[model samples]
Target: EPLPYSAILQPGHTLGMMGGGQLGRMFCHAAQSLGYKVVVLEPTEESPAGRVAEYEVVSAYDDMKGLDTLLSYTQAVTTEFENVPAASLKYLSSQIRISPSAAVVAVVQDRIAEKTFIASQGIPVAPYAEIRTIEDLEKADNTLFPAILKAARLGYDGKGQARVKSVAEAVEAFKSFGEVPCVLEAMLPLKKEVSVVMARGFDGKIALFPIGVNTHINGILSSSVVGVEEIDPTIEKAAQEAAIKIALGLNYFGVMCVEFFILEDNRLVANEIAPRPHNSGHYTMNACLSSQFEQQVRVLAGMPLGSTDLLAPTIMLNILGDSWFAHGGEQAIEPDWASVLALPGVNLHLYGKAEARKGRKMGHINIVNKDPQQLIYYARQVSDILH
Candidate 1:
């Protein structure tokens, strides 16, 4: 159980964060804006969040000394990424108030458990089979072919996944993945990819932002657009309802993003759930009354949930490190920020990473306008400059 709202919300109270990625960096900004100090626990030195946090505990996720040090600094904690060791979160939860609890993280971090849990809640997920050994792959259903074999853990951004058309291919891929536990999911005809970002409070209140129409390039999220006109009304309502159902089922207590696949038949199939504020929800930073990161802080601090109203039709473009090599050179060249900035309704946010590598998420640009068409127009202009 978490501490009471009054105990956690005292002025100048420090909060602890579990990861130091770009998400943590934005989370630090939100926490600071709310008059709370942040401490980050990350093994890496000079991590994005570490740079912004008031203190950084330099230790591995499961390091007891580091966890102890973090507990000493803050009574409330939250994780920036789901991959953090569940044991570490469990240990921390014993001493401090943690949102989305260790149990939730444990369930969502593994593909097998996550899919099973979602389906058990009466939510629709793509047909999938668990592959723990070679026999499991051989015995998988024939209809599951033309499917994606994904490692059950530590896979993200197109990694640890392969498309297989037969049991032989699946076996090969499974061996290549070091025979790890995996899930074989049937691929569906996806008409569109959409996601809903919602925040649930300790009081069981849920606030969902508008659904984001998403696109992917090289299996990585390329862009997400949120607007009243972008999604069908029926699809939007179903997506929101499914998201709320999953939150309630998990008893989730933080900002979570549920990505869904809208099929050609207009059926909504849940793809996956991110236990933390997600990349797709980054648009909320500039277009909503409260950003997802701020909502995360509110949940962690036991504060009342904030409004999730969208203030404008917005498009968020992910700026990958590939942009730096657009000219094809050994040295990375910066994109023309002047041109991108000159465009109306362009909100540029660059993650302060020291180096640029292809496919790395350097930052994002949020283009907002009253006209939906203009939002799309501005997004293309920004892409032209960045690419």
Candidate 2:
């Protein structure tokens, strides 16, 4: 049996993390500040997380020797992204405790599996069907027209997806993906998109942050605003309850973000689940009593989950790589950070990435003020300058 929560991981113990992206970077900072050592396994040179960690294996996720080395230094392991192979976690779990175990990761790694699992739990999900062979596409219901065909695995940031209005179009899009597994989801008339970020502890207790109202551009999250507009109390309650149910059902032991789509009729349908800390939750880093990253560390360390009260009604803007390129998309030029930072109440966080490519997530900025409208306006002004 795994160790109990009473034996919480001590402050000086080390933690191993898979993936060295911004999520892992933030987790590392949180862990380090709490007096834990972090070891990162990432192939990218000078990865965002690795740069801050005490040790980085700098190898592929499946590197056997590197995995062993990471395990040698840490008491527990966790991942930063769902795309990390489930088998990798499984391999590591044999020797160490890993939160949001490989089994949980496997379920959300594929869109079809994710939706199916959610629906099986009596949770609503956007109507979707699995598509692998062309025959499956041929048999798809005509009602699913104007669907989005997305790769079942490894799709993120609006990549590996295509809009299909007909069976022929879906076939073409599937072929473009080399006939990889895909999911066809009927588009819904969305009233708004929202997400709930929460953490489950080793003892099965749960803590939830407030639901965030989100806006996306080209399927990439652009901004997350909380408390800017009044959400129906019923809808907010349902979203929060459903989020907790999902985490409990998974017996998840770390922070997870569940995205939901609120229809015009005020119904809530789960869109997708990320099995780790998410971009939408970045606002919590500065706006909440305890940030999501801090929650992640606490959970993995078998420590009690912390309070998630919102400290301020806030707006968070994602800084994408497009902001680095000129307005016409001709060449790369850094945005005027001096002017952007000059704006009061702006908290800027730039990932120490060496290069910026179009559509890449570079960093984010959070604006917090007691007045929600003013927060949104200031956030927009700063985003406009950055863009």
Q: Pick the candidate with the highest lDDT.
A: 1
Model 2: ten consecutive residues of lowest lDDT? 1-10
For model 2, how many clashes? Answer: 0
Query: What C-alpha lDDT, on a 0 to 100 scale, does residue 7 get in candidate 2?
Result: 63
lDDT score of residue 83 within candidate 1: 94
Residue pairs whose backbone atoms clash in candidate 1 = none
| Whole-model lDDT values for every prediction | 0.91, 0.89
lDDT of 2 by residue, 48-97 (tens): 99999999898888889988898888868999999888998998888788
What global local distance difference test value does model 2 have?
0.89
Q: State in Å the error of residue 145, model 1.
A: 1.2
